[model samples]
Target: MPGFPAAGPPGGPQRSSAETYAQVQASPEFAALRRRWRGFIFPVSALFLIWFLAYVLLSAYAPGIVNTRVGGSNITVGLLFGLLQFVSTFAIATIYSRFAEKELDPEASRLRAEVEDSL
Candidate 1:
């Protein structure tokens, strides 16, 4: 145990090893998940933040864009957004796929194996 590296804090990312391990002990799956998915989470969060803010801004100040009609059958501008919403979700899934298969899954799997081996 002396040679094994410690973990960090739970709830969120922290600078200390104790904090990280506290997190690992609390959620064994997340310990490895955090390592693999951390990279994806940050940028994804930022993108979501920007996306949310854009949606808020559009809904608030850009009502015209939200209500613009596309077809004679009374297509609202927001209806177009439903399509974008699906696109965005799919895009995020795609991004996660690349990250998971390429980096996160492998690292997490390796760490998980290491942890299991220790047990």
Candidate 2:
């Protein structure tokens, strides 16, 4: 096959998959890429979870607050908070897309190239 590695002689092994994986995992570029990914993902995930929990808790324990009118309008605090959830979700997606484009995509591409070359 064009892309597949050549088969070894009968009863013989070809390249070690473990060794190939270890080499890729051991690369400094791969390490840095992982660190950068986790650095952004963990904190953002925690923050969003906290924000969502807060909204849930407030709705469950303090209906009065959430139900309060907003500036004498038909809108309620709970309604706004629910809408804000959507807003925050979209905002986070946008921010992450930008982050990936600026901070992650290039490094990821390089790492992919390295892996392909190794293969």
Candidate 3:
């Protein structure tokens, strides 16, 4: 509530929901928003899945590499990699948050306001 924009007026023109939605869907702005979402989501999802799959495969089929000690430390390669998974997850979340804030939210807010004002 503190950070988000205030809502528009409650009452608006009495139009069919389908008509409003169709109008919005037909807008180029909506198309660009969808494209931006997919552009970020698809590649990030693919990369994370690949990384996870590699970790799983390594753990199952190549224990020697996964279990190897790092330097004189007690930490194993598997442990490091496992820890890195969490780090990467947080990093990606931060990146996405920044990206959405910078590139997506403003456009989405504009679209939302436009729809609300029309409604």
Question: Top model by TM-score, which number?
Answer: 3
Residue pairs with backbone overlap in model 3: 12-119
lDDT of 2 by residue, 28-114 (tens): 777888899999999999999999999999999999999999999999999999999999999999999999999999978876665
What lDDT does the true structure give each of the candidates? 0.67, 0.84, 0.84
Clash pairs for candidate 1: 7-17, 7-20, 7-21, 8-19, 8-20, 8-21, 9-19, 9-20
Judged by lDDT against the true structure, how good is candidate 3? 0.84
Model 1: CA > 4 A from native: 1-36, 71-73
TM-score of 2: 0.84
For model 3, residues 62-94, the per-residue Cα lDDT tens digits are 999999999979999999999999999999999
Better of 1 and 3 by lDDT: 3
Q: How would you encode candidate 1's per-residue C-alpha lDDT over 28-102 as one tens digit per residue?
A: 566656755776788897987687678768878999998888876587777777667678888888988887898
- What residue runs in model 2 are displaced by over 4 Å at the alpha carbon? 1-14
RMSD of 2: 4.8
| Cα lDDT over the full model 2 | 0.84
Q: What is the C-alpha RMSD of each candidate to the true structure, in Å?
A: 9.0, 4.8, 6.0
- Where does candidate 2 clash, by residue pair? none
Order of quality (lDDT)? 3, 2, 1
Model 3, position 25, has a per-residue lDDT of 84
